[model samples]
Target: MTDAPILIRSVEVLSDDWATLKKFTFDYRRRDGTLERQVRQTYDRGHGAVILPYDPERGTVLLVRQFRLPAYVSGHPGPLVEACAGLLDEDDPETCIRREAQEELGYRLRDTESVFHVFMSPGSVTERLMFFIARYSPDDRIGQGGGDRHEGEDIEVLEVSLEGALGMIDEGQIVDGKTIMLLQHLKLKGLMRASAHP
Candidate 1:
């Protein structure tokens, strides 16, 4: 703890096609004062932002279904249900999520609440995601959102009741990490359920 915990020895580019992938050699200091050399490959796809837009009056939440190659490759038979999210190419977190909400969900975010920033996959992926939640009504929709066609995105928009969304989680229907987190957060906060129950 007294000295630097890690020391980088070398780095090599593994791939740079879509995102940057690099192999790193580093010296890691153990708790017992032993230094060990290790190698790790990291995929750098850049950080991103995700949002869950909820309609309190309707008790429903907006979501999307999209074809994720990685998920498909991992044995999922169909598109994954997920929150609206996008890589923060050049915009800040708030700006990134707002634009993503419009593009992927067709809803204009009026007031978004920042929840947290998390590394969904910290071991091999160097991408952090900012999480958010916001209120949306029927009037906020401004477009037919199916993601960017040029980007090969054919997203399906879904609006489900909050309780139904939770049931989907239990049934293993919604498996995306960010979506699960946001849904659970909303339920835990009792954002809409509290008033309904009382």
Candidate 2:
């Protein structure tokens, strides 16, 4: 994958209130030796990390339910279930995830395995997420994490059976993309299994 055939023309900042949104105009060389002018807008909310906490012995996964204004405005009934995640800010992906784990789920995960990296919304969002999974036990619980109140966060923690969680997906209850992907990853890798079902 080489970008030698592409040439950038200009970039304009459209909005920079809470996040940076920019419009880019560029020239692209087609396979037929033709140049094309294209324009696109991208919103950059910064990169982040997501972690799914699993307890294989009990076949359980930890998730969070929190209100998302965007989802609500887009027609969601209420809060959305999602993996514990946060923006990297200036920290590394691992560090950011660990921080978010403690802040969102009250678990201080000892070790985490990176699953993959993905752009959650590539078409209009310039944000990439590093996906990770960690094993946690009851002993890992630390604080009563519901997020910092001052940040306008009112998160509700959920401890769900893997089977039940998957059912939620089929039932349209678990609509968060990142959370769904991580849950499917666990099922694919045989990381967590419902003993009765299989």
Candidate 3:
């Protein structure tokens, strides 16, 4: 019925090696009958995929655990168990997800499929996240992957059955929003149900 808030102006650029920040000034019209102009703010951050690589035969999925400052500050008990995800650079979402999978989990995802794109924090942060799914096989020889040293990432990869992942979500072990959304999407689509019994 009512119009969404309008962005009158915006300025954005890549800040760090792989980070993009944007400043937005916008105006909104109130319901009663008032024109309110304000300099609202949002970040057009490029968040990559949370790949839930499923093995139809094995009924397994890959998950990752890592410390997140925002989650901690928001009253989460500890670090989060999530899917392999990161920010996209100038590259497309597919490229970003592939790089993150290898860097964070020591897993190479082939035939990556785009699931959907979502806004992680639409209310405040303009972070557009792309979700993807890929198939991968276990490799015992895969070396430790905790992301690049320069990026200061210490990640631990986990191979769990889809049922186990669902349990983690139910127990609140997976606190990341993107991860939750992806899992829910898979559940709703009946993809996880075929292989994973919960």
Candidate 4:
């Protein structure tokens, strides 16, 4: 068995905010009477959710393409195609995902199920992302959904076949990490089936 490290000292956070800088300090000890100290950094934390809506009969999936500043600044010149995703405010994970779907794609989801929850960048940020999956018919008419103009979101919804979507992943067209993880999960579970439209 390995020896457990001792906490010699620690620092606690009294308050934090979205735009405020924060820091944490920790002190530890080894079995040989040696002391060690480390400082961890954190930033404004947020939550995100990804939704994978599948149409079983059509073998298609709903995806959205949008402009992302992070991607654009990081060298990706083209828009990003990803599953419906958004930040969680004061609502539950499920509710946040449902609302994001409608706002981003104009699609209403039913019988949503949790796929997984992950931390996008735990080492430097406090963003927790929840992933979900739902079944929907592709034939359903989704009104124009481009997010709220006040929020500056202009999203384009796309319905592509499962094979095509997988191809996009292979071609690196779908570069969003959360979307990639959710698609992998669906493929692994063999739940990438199409639903019959009414």
Each candidate structure's TM-score, on Cα atoms with residue i matched to residue i, is 0.95, 0.95, 0.81, 0.83
Better TM-score candidate (3, 4): 4
> In candidate 3, which residue pairs clash?
none
lDDT of 1 by residue, 1-198 (tens): 237999999999989988999999999999899999999999999999999999887788999999999899999999999999999999999999999999899889989999999999999999999999999988999998999999999999998888888889999999998999999999999886422311
As for TM-score, the candidate ahead, 2 or 4, is 2
Q: lDDT score of model 4? A: 0.79
User: lDDT of all the models against the reference?
Assistant: 0.91, 0.91, 0.74, 0.79
Worst 10 residues of 4 by lDDT: 1-10
TM-score of 4: 0.83
Candidate no. 1 TM-score: 0.95
Q: Pick the candidate with the highest TM-score.
A: 1
Poorly placed runs, candidate 3 (over 4 Å): 1-25, 30-34, 139-142, 193-198
Cα lDDT of model 3 by residue, 1-198, tens digit: 256645465555535354455555556677776777676555555555567777656777888888888778888867789888877768788888888888888877788889888877788676788899877767522667787888888888788877778788888788677777777766677664345433
Error of 3 at 150 (Å): 2.1
- Model 2 scores a C-alpha lDDT of 0.91
Ordered from best to worst lDDT, the candidate numbers read 1, 2, 4, 3
Whichever of 2 and 4 has more lDDT, that candidate is: 2
